[model samples]
Target: MDCIANLASEKAVVIFSKSLCCMSHAITRLFQEQGVSPMVHELDQHPRGKEIEMALKRLGCTPAVPAVFIGGKFLGTANSVMTAHINGSLNKMLKDAGALWL
Candidate 1:
């Protein structure tokens, strides 16, 4: 959890994800499509992934993987990202938060 927080703090955009998760892949694709290069942390591949999972649950995510963060803050899950994209606010949010220059 500390590592996760540290990485999030260091990066403009961060994604805590599992490599094999479709939602995670979708989130990654979404950012790429928008020209944002996020720092993706594949928790499932890490030794402390389960600990991170527990930490995410504490952070208020139900299904924690694919959690998004911007400006060192918890943003939301993939569903939130999708909703933000559909409503046309994700791009603006990313731009305003300095996650995307575009």
Candidate 2:
């Protein structure tokens, strides 16, 4: 929880993912294409995976891979992220999160 809090507070964007998840890959690609290098937390390798689980639970989100946070707010799962991107809301979100200068 502390790590995630720190990440959320310190970084403009953070993405939590597991290995080989298609959704994760897609979201990663999108961020990369937009030149946003989000801080990535690989839950599978994380010893504190339970903390992430608890955090998700507290946020009232289903335990899913590729959960994203911007400016300390839970943005939701990969599908939501993709939808935001397609709707042209992601860049604005990033900007609001202070993840991008422009």
Q: lDDT for every model?
A: 0.87, 0.79
Residue 11 of model 1, lDDT score: 75
Count the clashes in each prediction: 0, 0
Query: Which portions of model 2 miss their true places by more than 4 Å?
Result: 1-3
Q: In lDDT terms, how accurate is model 2?
A: 0.79
lDDT of 2 by residue, 1-102 (tens): 677777666677788887777778778778888888888887778898767867866776565668888888889887788889899999999988777777
Per-residue lDDT for 28-67 in model 1, tens only? 8999888888988899888888888889989888899899
TM-score, every prediction? 0.91, 0.83
Taking every candidate in turn, the Cα RMSD to the unseen true structure, in Å, is 1.3, 1.8
How does model 1 fare in lDDT? 0.87
lDDT of 2 at 52: 81
